[model samples]
Target: MSDFWLDLGFRANPYAVRALAPTADGRRLLVGRDDELAALTKRVRNSDLHPVLEGQNGVGKTSLVAVAAYVMSQDFKEGRSQQLFLPLGEPLQMKDDGSELIRDVYFAIAQAFIAHHDDLRAAGRRVPRVDDLETWLNAPTYRSSKGGGVSTPLGGGYATTGTGLNTGSAFTDSGFQTMLRRALQEAFPGNSGGFVGTLDNLELLDTSSSARRVLEEIRDPVLQLPGLRWVLCGARGIARSLANTPRLNGVLADPVDLLPVERRYIESLIDARVHVFSVDESGRANTPVNADGFGYIYDVSNENLRDTFGYAQDFALDHDPAFFLDSSPAEIENSLMAWVDNLAEKSARDVRLQGRMWRLLEDLATAGGTAAPGDHDAYGFNDRTHMRKNVVELERFDLAISSRDEVDGRRRSISLTSKGWLVHFAKKRDLLGQGALDLSMTNESPEV
Candidate 1:
């Protein structure tokens, strides 16, 4: 007889960060950031300036903003709010004249309201779906095949190309607003406090003059519409660029900056991610691991790499053997060796590393680096210009840094705390460490 055994303890690390799961359990996945989420919900309830979220990258700004849109869709049902999620990239490409963006936004809004009607119908509520109620609410307005003129739901009205009302069944660039107001009122019936919610990433569609104009025109008025609320997600660059535009200056106003998720808040977000990835019906872990692994790798690497480098270089010239013999050198060597060994081990495990890498890259990209004022909005790195775009993409993960290799060979850099990194990676990678990771610096070579 032959005995065979496999070391189950060793699983090849995928080496690639997990592809973002599309849903949480059987439902849409919503992770981390209760306060930020609540703040956005509050913004939906009160603010008119349009809730704007800005972060260095990989901070889950887009996802958070999207979650806000979904929340409004679910919470404000009675408000008859329509969630219009428009990616700026697609719209800008189709409608170079800016007419396409406006029409698309209106169409998207109308569809949202229409879906709201369907939801009501699904619940056995008597309210007519937009299709059935079109006689009174006017459904044909935005159905224009002409690709010109603004016509809204009310039918038989005239409007500009991008902004107009629906005149029955044809598309025209006119009279869209009149129909919209009536439709909204009809949907809400003048007192129930219904709303129309529009979520757009303005930076995607309009990075140029025409695009910006379209955004301002579409978003400005939407911001002020009585029961219509807009939560727009955009790069900080886009927002800054739009700041001085005459028309948008006041109408869109200054957006409430959706800052990066703070450590505590991110902890909460990681918890949510845990719940989302949970194997249970409630989608929550009974004992959540403290942090995401990839995020941990990135953060720990960043911290130890920077700190170790700094310590080594800082005292390199000093060569204080007493320090290493005492607390500093031993710590430095231990920390560096541990991180370096961990990275190698992680690579060996084929652990999905994007999130961690992104975290590290993002921190590096954003921490104290200077770019030409013109280069700020760009997403990638320019090695010649001392920039890395990979970090930008990773910044979406909100882990990045800025550094300079100084003349003294000391690299000035920034990093996240191990605890912070742990939580981040755990949430992002959807895996918790089997046991607490020892962070203390020691003289032994790091062994996984």
Candidate 2:
């Protein structure tokens, strides 16, 4: 069968929003992050401090990092300054002794060094000490049984082999750090550029003291290195958790928050993506897909870039492409709401938090989708602790948005997100018939 994306006239699956692939060209299809990108670029160029990027899921934290890396690489190409952005393959897993985490970090840096050298050589530039760096990075190293015994060559004839080197001992060796630094310097070959290590999904780090201590030990000294900058990205909850750790006081700079893009920017994003996939008989690019379909998607997705692309892609696959060109707004909206309803119903079945979620949604609906923090008491949550936990859960699931009330200025409130409202309305209408409590006053959608 033909692939759905190809059938829809896309050159590639434009909605394939994985962590920006490492080898991908940095010219990403991004939208509405100009200010954030500028600030990130400045931080990377001007400081060696480890900065944290915090945001809700799907707010494009990974994309932001990719663009920043691309910009820094451009700077190097254009003779601005030298700072190679080396993103880790994945976020470090929180471990008990920190040995595994450190080992992974070391391996990722080594791989980046190798890639940079390969790139330089491919461009006909002289990369001095390339042989020495490859030898060191590929040297047989001990690995714990848990580390597995997979060996893979990471380009340029260098292969990382698991030769039974003790994971803890290898990192503890006094000369490892020095050797790694020397190899990095050799690869870059001048004081012009340094290395920026981009680590995403740091919210995975365990909250255990042992884990944090290990993180601090491995992280703090690296920040002091004149040529290296570490950028950690994760959700806001993790940022708050890390902020309270006494040992991490000065090690972490203020976090850069990636907020939601405006509605206009989201519309532009849809247009941009549609243009990428649309083509004429001459094989030239053409106008975007139906504006009505795009607007309906924008409204349903609440202006989230990830969801906008996802719904648009799904809409294309579910109906004939011809229908999409002149789609009805009502038809598209109804289809989107149905998709959202199914998603919400499945999500609400989470065994751990189902009861609390239903109750919280009920309260939000009763309050017209917005309620002060103190409103939980009227909903059978007697104390702030219980209410706060449920609110956190709601935020984690993207079901509720907690923000300061604009009218009241100083008071914080919790409100149903678009998805949340859909699910709440469905339950009130007895569509799901899950026997959920109906605390709402009317069937009308909330003012939000």
**Winning candidate number (lDDT):** 2
Best by TM-score: 2
In the range 343-362, model 1's lDDT, one tens digit per residue, is 33343232223433433333
Q: What do the candidate models score in CA lDDT, each in turn?
A: 0.40, 0.56
Superposed Cα RMSD, model 1: 15.0
- Which portions of model 2 show Cα errors greater than 4 Å? 21-28, 82-97, 118-174, 186-191, 206-211, 220-226, 241-246, 277-304, 318-334, 341-359, 362-385, 388-431, 437-448
Candidate 1, residue 95: how far the Cα is off, in Å: 7.1
Model 2 error, position 106 (Å)? 0.9
lDDT for residue 28 in candidate 1, whole number 0-100: 40
Question: In model 2, how large is the Cα lDDT of residue 122?
Answer: 45
Instruction: State the lDDT of candidate 2 residue by residue for 1-448, as single tens digits.
Output: 5555555566765555565543333344566778888898787766645777877556787777766776777666676765554443444444554556666666666666566776666434344354544665566654222233333223222233344453457555534455555555555544444556665555444232333566677664454444456677765245544544677777666777777776666556655555555543343432223445555555544445566656556645666554534556566556656665565465444323356566676777675555555565676676656676777877775778764322332233455666665465556545453333242222433221
